[model samples]
Target: MITKDVRNWLGALTFLISLCLSGCQSGNAPASSPIETNRSLAPQRVDIRGSILSSQYSDGQVILEVERLSPSPDSRYDRAYVLVLPTAQMVDSEGLSVSISELRPGQNVAILLRAGGQGNRTGIGVARKLWIEDRF
Candidate 1:
């Protein structure tokens, strides 16, 4: 025959143990785990230093001949990349805002692009930012 006080204490201890077990089995990874740092879950951004091959402001597009300056060189980046510039922020060497029409062929440039996806093998990407590295 257990006393009332002992029963209450056992019940409370059982509740706490169950609570702790439930918390440990919640199935969430720790903050610093590799799962939490998976790159695929984040937006992929590519940066390239290249020369402008051509531009069509009316069509809001620019063709860049990649020089493969960042993220290590890869054969995939050896070709020209067609960058869509409709919403891109372009700046000149002086850091002043500019337009696609102001860009010229043969001008050195640094571009930040958002990777379209794995199925996009045509080298077409959306330009997030473009910096004209040469002064006209």
Candidate 2:
């Protein structure tokens, strides 16, 4: 009972639906949603460690002033400003649970930064991983 024009429209709709379903089935690609357009793509990870010269926490985010205890021969920052998020894990000298709020100035710590963009005026890098060394 379908006319020729109606059949063609149905065929096109079916093709589009199939394409969408295939994409969904893959399950790897993110679905269409609002994306942050201003932020740059994630960058390569890096590692830095030093004594805590200063620590600032607000709105569940942290910026630490770390004086590199020992820098690589080519290190650009004898003291670097490192960014840490609330999601970053924290541990104590004995490898037990610690809170970011306990971190104070003059504590020796090590930080691992992942997906941090290159520095400009903001600071050195953003930290994806952070650990507090035993200040004892």
Candidate 3:
């Protein structure tokens, strides 16, 4: 027969296992593929000084240039990377290549990030946000 402590430990182990298994779903899709969907997304545009774009942000974030801008059925915009100023950094430790649809060229891709969805001023979308400006 198992003690009460053993039962609690088993429960915690089960919970952690379940969480780990759920995370594996993202592994099926490679990082470079375009996200094709019809999900509704409203993207807000912002223009920042190109000279200051890289200096203001913390590490793990970068000011990438928009290489291409495509319209997806899901998000209002699909940006691809043409060039990245400073260096190309990974998001959330996922060293996966930043996709072509995730940026565009000639324009500063990201300088100020928005939390969650790119609107909040105080929140930094450091782990999961891409900043981009389309207008010159």
Using TM-score, give the best candidate's number. 2
lDDT of 1 by residue, 66-120 (tens): 4543343422443346565657887765557887677777776666667631223
What is candidate 3's lDDT per residue for 1-136, written digit by digit as tens?
Answer: 5788899999999999999988998767786533223111213432222212222233533434232234323232233212233343422112244533344334343332233323222222322333433343
Model 2 clash pairs are: none
Q: Rate residue 129 of model 2 by lDDT.
A: 62
Which 10-residue window in model 3 sums to the lowest lDDT?
A: 47-56
Q: How many clashing residue pairs appear in each of the predictions shown? A: 0, 0, 14
| Model 1 spans with C-alpha error above 4 angstroms | 1-46, 60-76, 116-122
Evaluate all candidate structures by whole-model CA lDDT and list the values in order.
0.58, 0.65, 0.36
- Lowest summed lDDT over 10 consecutive residues: which window, candidate 2? 35-44
Q: How do the predictions measure up, each by TM-score? A: 0.48, 0.54, 0.22
Top candidate by lDDT: 2
Q: How would you encode candidate 2's per-residue C-alpha lDDT over 83-112 as one tens digit per residue?
A: 777777666545566677888998877666
Q: Indicate the residue-level lDDT of 96 in model 1.
A: 76
Model 2, position 41, has a per-residue lDDT of 20
